[model samples]
Target: MRELRIRAGYETLGELHRASGVTVATLSRIESGVQIPSPKTLNRLAPFLKVSVEDLLAAAGYLPEKEEDPNEAAARTIEAAISDDPELLEFWQELVKRDDLQLLFKQVKPLTPKSIKKIIKVIKAIEDAEATED
Candidate 1:
């Protein structure tokens, strides 16, 4: 927390107190490891330090460290692609809600715009085939 405070340019507890409204004494205690910051305290400090409360909690040993899941990371990439094209957003939003298509979406994270359109067509064709089979 102290490193975060310093990295954010808060040189002293007084500076942090002025910006975060947390008392200097409490900030000092937290930084010196004399006290574990409560969730409320972490919430107050996180914004001033430009970090999430979860990060502060993890640093303070309150929460387990987070690891990014590959599928979720891939989904974020796909979502970024969808957001960049308004035309894609509507269709992509619906497609992304399908659990069966999740692995396909992950595999296509690096697709070009043309490739995305091709994939969309293939997906539509598959859906049509499945409907006829039903």
Candidate 2:
């Protein structure tokens, strides 16, 4: 965390604190390995540091760093793709909540790689369309 922050040009805890809205004490503790950051803190800091929440969580030992199942990886990839797009993500959340989609997902709980790829493609298409519209 400290190395990444320093690489990102945050020379001091105060600079990180101001940019991340995390307290200097908390940043100090985290950098010193005396304390791990909470999810909220990671979320706030990840963007400023140009890192992903999963990467931060893994580095903090909150999430496993090992390779996950393909389905889980696919889900994470999709989430990462949408993380910067609030409108598209909001639409995705609503679409996921639909009964038809929910039932379809239940029927395919352990998603196949091909299906996951297709889902990602569909989402990308939607996001692209939205961007073009904007």
Locate the minimum summed-lDDT window of 10 residues in model 1. Answer: 105-114
Per-residue C-alpha lDDT of model 1 across residues 15-91, encoded as one tens digit per residue: 99999999999988988889998999999888989999988899888999898887777666556655666656666
Please, what are the lDDT tens digits per residue for candidate 2 over residues 1-134? 87899888999999988988899999999889898889989999998888899999998889899675654444455556565667656666656545655445434555554555567568668867998999
Backbone clashes in model 1, listed as residue pairs:
none
RMSD of each: 7.8, 9.6
Pairs that clash in candidate 2? none
**Model-by-model lDDT, in order?**
0.79, 0.75
After superposition, which runs of candidate 2 have C-alpha atoms over 4 Å from their true positions? 66-134
